[model samples]
Target: MRIAQVCNVGEICGGTAACAWSITLAFPDVDHTVIFLSPPNSRTVEAFQHCQFHSAKSITDGMIRHLNVDLVILHNSTPNRVAQIRSTPSIQYHHSMGSRTAADVHLACSKWLHQRTPQSTQVLWQPTPIPIQRTDNPSRNAATSLRIGRICTPDDRKWPQSLIPLYERLAESFKNVEWEFIGAPGTLRESLQHACRGNARFITADVSARSRYWSWHALLYHHPTISESFGRTVAESMRCGTVPIVDRKGGFCEQIESGKNGFLCTNPDDFVAAIHQIQDRNHLSQLSQRAQDSSHEKCSLSIFRSRFLRILNQLSLGDSFDA
Candidate 1:
């Protein structure tokens, strides 16, 4: 069947974009057209094959008409787009539904995200995939000291000012620990620079590419976030055999099993203390192994594709689609 995946493609360089790509790639037999809200970069556009791309403004006229789209999948709800496409068989896969009106079918990346939507909305759990292959890197097991890291896009909503004091304290208290901040360089430069100042143990790394970002030693540190639908980076870290020290917020609780896979911190002091506790080589290895195993079962590409296809079948759209 002909399907139209309508999304703000340009705005998505992270998990949401990866989810869209996974869906399209997984169902290759189905005719898929990506209706990008904004034009994607040359590299991003080249990634998808056998998929037609259209501008958001022309989506209503050009996309629906030309493609004769059987089903429209809305990633993020646009003001009138959902209503406009309501007549057609549409599914709204919410990265974060926010305050928008519910769609015909709502899919959430995590249980926390699913609960926020209307009860009438259909809930499908769609987690992000870990692109990096699992490796037996010697460095992952060799380190005895805790290596805490944070990844964000330099948004205040993500890396809040509250984390500044926490990060400073961790740097000061921990002797054998190192803190790394990875994201857009200049965006959080001032804040990160100020927080790490005089604390030679803190390192701020500019992550312009996914490869570079995932190359670090494991044991990610994510403080409590105010608003997050799902944390894909944490899962990705797990896939690379890196344990995550996440706050008890959003999908973090769902991803980690407290001491089983990784530590769940309630506050800044708890986060630091957890780090100190897991600094032992044996404990770190066990945690890393558990994390990798968890990623394989819950967030792997194969599992995501199989679960997604099964969901479509249960929705009775599987037979309708060519694949």
Candidate 2:
């Protein structure tokens, strides 16, 4: 089927952009096109090489009509363009649905969003692929210090001032532990530099993704947002065999099995406690394996593609009706 995905392909490698990346690469068989709402960049152009790329402003309904497109998927749409179209099957594939309730079809990224969406809105669970393959055995060097990785938006929610005390304590108590944070605000960057001024304990990186999760023991993902719509990075880390110590609330609870696959922290204290729980290499290694196992079993690429194809088949069978 001919399909078009409209999204804001920003420079920052966010969950939405990552989801789009996964979709394009996984479904190359379909006549898929990405209509980027934002200014196109080399990064996005290269990423969507398999699919046709177009700017949203340049793309008219006539073009979609000309292509005989069957479906239009909206990603993070604030003011949906789907409302203008009456002939095509438009689905709001939501990362955040905002205030709108009435839509032809609403596909949620997580169960949390599905539960929160209007009952009248047709909600379906569409899990995001980790964009990486799972490793059977996670790597760990017993001779070196523990490596803890964190990738966040640099907001107060992700890198809160509240956690400053805990950071100080962790830096002081565990000299063997090294914290690696990526994408932080200038204030946070300066503060972290000051905090770790005496030693080389905290390191900041500017890379696409740390592929060394296989070597890392755990990923600390504690955000003040209470619950995320979906924890994409946490799942990504898990796919690389790195256990995530995530928050207990929201969509994070859906991703982690709590102690089995990964640890779920309640607060900063709980986060500290969770770290204490990881004492030896054996426990860390086992949790790492379980993390990858859970990711492979729960959020594999095959499952995503299969479920997506099944949805399309149902739609083709005239099962897609406005809720």
lDDT of each: 0.63, 0.65
lDDT of 1 by residue, 1-323 (tens): 77788776543444555567667766767787787767765645765555877666534534455667777777775655534454456677877866443455667777888888663244454554555433442243444555556776434556566666776677667755645665524545566555655432333322233332244555555554465677777777787777788777888788889888887788777777777767666786788789889978887766766666666775577776533
Model 2 sits at a Cα RMSD from the real structure of: 4.4
lDDT of 1: 0.63
For model 1, the stretches where C-alpha displacement exceeds 4 angstroms are: 28-31, 46-51, 58-62, 86-88, 99-103, 119-122, 133-139, 142-146, 154-156, 184-187, 197-208, 212-225, 320-323
Off by over 4 Å in 2: 57-63, 80-84, 100-103, 119-139, 154-163, 196-207, 317-323
Evaluated against the true structure, the overall lDDT of model 2 is: 0.65
Per-residue alpha-carbon lDDT of model 2 for 1-323, expressed as tens digits?
A: 66777776543356676677677655656678777767766665766677877776544457657667778776765544433344676666777646532335667888887777663243343444553333542345553777776776535566776545656766666666767676565667666655544443333422244454555678887666456888877887888788898778777888888888888887677777767777666887788889888887767666676667666665572343221
Model 2 TM-score (2 dp): 0.83
- Which lDDT value does model 1 have at 242? 73
Model 1 RMSD to the real structure? 3.8
Against the true structure, whose lDDT is highest? 2
